[model samples]
Target: MEKRKFLVVVDPSHERHLALERMLDIVTQRRESIANFHLLVGFEGADKADPNAPSEVIRGKQWFDELMAPVDATGVDYTVEFFWTANWRKSITDAAERFECDTIMLCESSAEHKRGITDSKWDLVRQARCDVVIVDEGTEAPIKTILAAVNTQAKDAGHQALNDRILERGKFLAEYFNADYHVVNAYTDSENFPDRQKISRMSGLPREKIYRDMGKPEDVIAATAERIGADMVIIGISPRTGLSAKFASHTTEKVMEKITVDVVALN
Candidate 1:
């Protein structure tokens, strides 16, 4: 297994204190296994010096020096940078691209817009070229179990080549964290609930553990996490929107909101 490269975007909020600590723990534990580590901090550029003079840009170097005071030595080849930009999400995406990061972790910032027509994080997640992990910050402890909310492959659609790709990704993370992997294929009918057999077969999970639940996607994920005692819920992010609302099957913002368990969302 190749060590995954990670890019962590830090925010200026105090609530993010726990999130940063938790992130530090995860990175520290997997230091040896990480190929590259990048921490990016971005602050909004001043009004471009009255709109035409151009914004005062922070220099490229040592931006993270102050924040990384606690952990002097970050695992893997590490780099910290500071950027002054109007768009946080754009900065994150640009930095991740420049570093060729495989995964980017998003920490909600203190300056997060409470009521807005646009969501910065949502724009970033949807536009990211690489896998993105959207976090609410300072969740809980080490994840004991991760529930991967997978959609059934439309085998009859003639596009079901191997199996659901989400299944494989879910299994991979479960194995990576040494957490119990639960695959729940939901259905409305009690009779069809036994379709757990199909989900188990596809996910290579124990069938008896899968159950049928009829409810909103958020409800199902939250309920399953509580019932299964899962520490993290792994959901997918595809085609993110400005609102980033929990529109259903798999999305980052929704999973994070509905579950008390730490959410490990994947893109």
Candidate 2:
């Protein structure tokens, strides 16, 4: 069997360390399925002030070494990499592509009071080609429940594909933790939306566990997660404009900012 490869962004100053630890725990729990772990760090590009690029690479090496010393002791197949680029979103996507990573894991930074979902985090979610897990402050306790938020009234095929991705990822997590898995669909009009059975078939969710509620998508998903005591919620993310564009508050951003539990935003 092929081992799963995880591309994890390790930032020492931010709360991203929690995401690194969470990924390590998941690898330890499912060693047979996870094959390799690759750690990546992006640094400032060399400028007139700091013309030496190798210096940054060496510094990044030192940083990653100290961060992953414990994991090395555990004898996992892992590699460390450094990319000196001003564009973080591009650098991360490039690293994932180079390593053929199965999942790209990122630590979501603390959201600004008025602005939700930092620019860097949101950019990566939009640019990355593979599935991205935007981890919030994670919990030490085992995950007991997971909620897969989907859009049954998707206007196009791309949106439906994202919903499928979210459900598939959610199912994998639920089985991995042996936890309860539930699917939620919040639509504006139930008359035109697919029924519970159709959603189950499309999302691979059990008919009994599928929930069709009425309200705003983000609000309904957040409420369902709270009511079910969900430890994690998986939701699909849509691509936005380029990084240069102004940050627009989208549904995924609202959901991530409002949800209390860990959120996995599938790209």
Candidate 3:
């Protein structure tokens, strides 16, 4: 089997450590066969403004070491990488590409809207070619359930492909954490709406775990997550503009604003 590689971005916040620690817990629990975790910390140019400042790379190493001290790194191989750059969004995506990471995980920065209407968190969702798992800083509970918001009425092939990817990844996560996997499809009216049963079978989940409702996708997804206390919601995302962009934004970005759990966005 090909090795699974995860790129974990670490910021200065304790939340960053939390995200990495949670991921380690899941990996340990699942006993993932062959995996490599790459921890990355990017220092803006300002942080390295002093030519004599202790090396950012060295500092990054010390920080990651402390973070991993309590973590049990038994099965997977792990590495720490650091870069000095001002464009963090670009740097993160670049590192993922260079390392060929299967997924990129990071703690959700409260600065989600710092860059006006274009936040780095959402930008990563749009730009990253791989799966992006944004861990809410406030989430500390062991994951017990995962909700996958599927757009069954999606007209485009891209969206359909993404939906499949979402379910696939969701199932893997559920198995890893021994969590319940639920599928939700929010539709408008009933005509030509997605069949919850079909999605249930496709996801290989028990029929009773499937849910279909008529309403806005974001509201329905948020409600379901709250009802079930979903530890994570796996959804699809893409870089888009105009009307398509609005749909993409509503599905994942808007939902993120309403929920407190982690989100795994498959691109």
**How do all models score by TM-score?**
0.76, 0.81, 0.82
Q: Report lDDT (CA) for all predictions.
A: 0.60, 0.73, 0.74
- How many times do residue backbones clash in model 3? 0
Per model, how many backbone clashes are there? 1, 0, 0
The sequence of per-residue lDDT tens digits that candidate 3 reaches over residues 1-267 is 245688888765333455677667656655454477788865545466667544433454566667777554464677778676768778999889988898898776533342122466677787888888887754555778899988877777877887788888888878767788999888978795887677877799887888787887778888998888788888777536799787767666777766677888777
Better of 1 and 3 by lDDT: 3
Comparison by TM-score, 2 against 3, better one: 3
- Estimate the overall C-alpha local distance difference test score of candidate 3: 0.74
TM-score of 1: 0.76
Which candidate would rank higher by lDDT, 1 or 2? 2
- The C-alpha stretches of model 1 lying farther than 4 A from their native spots are 13-15, 44-66, 73-76, 108-118, 153-163, 188-194, 238-253
Pairs in clash, predicted candidate 2? none
Q: Quote the lDDT for 191 in model 2.
A: 79
